[model samples]
Target: MSNTQKINSTITHASINKCAIPYIRYKLVKKPPEKYIKSLQLDLFSQFVTNDKSEVSNTVEIWESIPKYFLTPAQVKKLRTDTGHADPYEWNYSEKGGNFTVRIQPALIKQGNNKYQAFFPGITEELVEEALKKILTIQNHGIHDVNKVETWVRFSLRMVLKELASRGRDRNINQIKHAIEVMSSCVITLSKEKKEIWKGSILQDLVTVGREEYLADTDAQHIGRLPLFISHAINQLEYRQFNYDRLMSCDEQLTRLIYKKLINRYRHANLINNYHFMYSDLKSTGLLQQNREIDNRKKVLSALNELKEKNIIANYETDERKESRAITDVKYIIYPSNEFISEQKAANKRNSDSDKHSIDPNLISVNKS
Candidate 1:
């Protein structure tokens, strides 16, 4: 499989609509001229790859012997297949089952109280500062009472924004601006009841981040853990509550796979199963007929079965008002959870907020004065 990368800055992405790079990166891993590299035999050269972390090669002794292990791309391919490995066992970046475009970034350093700084060229320093302020305020309260923690609160803010950029948000200015603010600012606050910041999906309106699947720390099949230099802020969502460190672990990798599979069928199984789908009600109200998808009773039944298997609702009976009015006419049904209303309310809340606080599109007009 040959691969190429497309790096974009809003304009290029607009002109080239298919610019969003998917999983998998291709590297030109080249071999050096024979006698010279062999003669030097430095410690950084790779030998055997364990879990694909190349950092382990530093332990090898016998300096001249190291160069022999610097295998060619063809040699690496043969060795990988010989060992029953499908990949070259190297640390690489990729999107879900898609090719990767190698992205490079400079490191960051913590500054004075409640501040952070990074050396990346593409983004503005002002943007970084504003994002850090918002995010730090939110997380600071989580880890320590904001009033007590005197200094910048010992957390890595840079990592969060970088997570967004790495997931491909940095490709567009509109998205970058939206994400930096969304990840940093307090769009929704905790409503004392669930300690849940039960606000609607804040970034839904903006083409800010990638799809929901990208919010998770995906597998090597997508991209490996983002570079450590970036902070948790990048991948953290205001409405979602997932642990960051654990998201990169092997267990999370498996969970991400399960989540993707399950979500692909989200509308069918989990959601429909829970709805007390009054076929008669949906039909009379025109939700079924107007929807065109659940036009007949069959899709509704299929959705109900999936819901039942997923345990989204409990079993019950449906009394068919106009059926042949028999005792056995009742069928089991599922009722949507109270949380469903919350999600809807949250969605509405998001709509209102967007109306109130959205950025002016004219400001973003490109290639013109």
Candidate 2:
């Protein structure tokens, strides 16, 4: 169509299909041998940035430059009447007042590390603080651009693949082939460079680390493979590539099938409590009936267990068998270490002397010692 198209066409569709596509493919790349391409339901070109208005105009120029030699102008005349070929060429870019808006989702543009101080370690903490103030604000609220929302996520995905490819090729040209062998997926097509640059599937490979589950299902779309969410899918397939309101029904006999060995090897020695137990106590303070004492025992025990797991209490004695309530160890001792003890004693002595010094001095000092 144009230089851009011609240049992009140089990209191996097979490669893109293998890696980045499965992670973002709209559909049509799934296959066997465990490698298939899938689209992540993104409009890749919509978010493409242009240098200026001239560049957008240049796209049409690129399309106009198609040679008339092997691909003669007659082909275009014939394609005008063709159905399948026309569909691929007909793109609606002018719908939004001359330019397609590309806005990335707030959650999608998230960097690998939200609060990380490393990797970008060379950057100063003060600078990091300011950058984060702005970055996190938009990240939480979503970016405001139509095309950005539409295409930025896929663009990020594209960046990931490109980076991976650049890394491998710079090191060993031969490694390119091996890399392709491993990354060659039938699902989606990507350039060899795209596969090599994209270290792993973006949603799964993890451009950087994050605290929560990286590929959450909120924006995920299904392509076959259960909920083949971004949780992870290999580019192994690129180019070569719920629930409903259930009707009420009677319960049926079900079979218990065990794929692996049955019994639990690790017995439930104990059920240690977590901080949530204490939080529950505070939270349920007013949420219960007048018979509070009835539930107090259970609540206290739950909190005690939680504190114990956290190593807040140190004396580890065996649980004594109990019959009648003999005032079970309700008291817990959290002893300070030697330094802490010394500091505390010093502080106490200082306070005691200060109190003594406060007594009226003139009344007792007249002996002239």
Clash number for every model?
19, 61
Tell me the tens digit of each residue's lDDT in model 1 across 173-243: 43444333332221221121122211211111111225353434222111111110111111111111111
**Cα deviation in Å at residue 105, candidate 1?**
20
TM-score of each: 0.23, 0.15
Residue 12 in candidate 1, Cα distance off native in Å: 14
Deviating ranges (above 4 Å) for candidate 2 = 1-343, 360-369
Candidate 1 clash figure, as a count: 19
Top candidate on TM-score is: 1
Name model 1 segments beyond 4 Å from true.
1-85, 88-336, 360-369
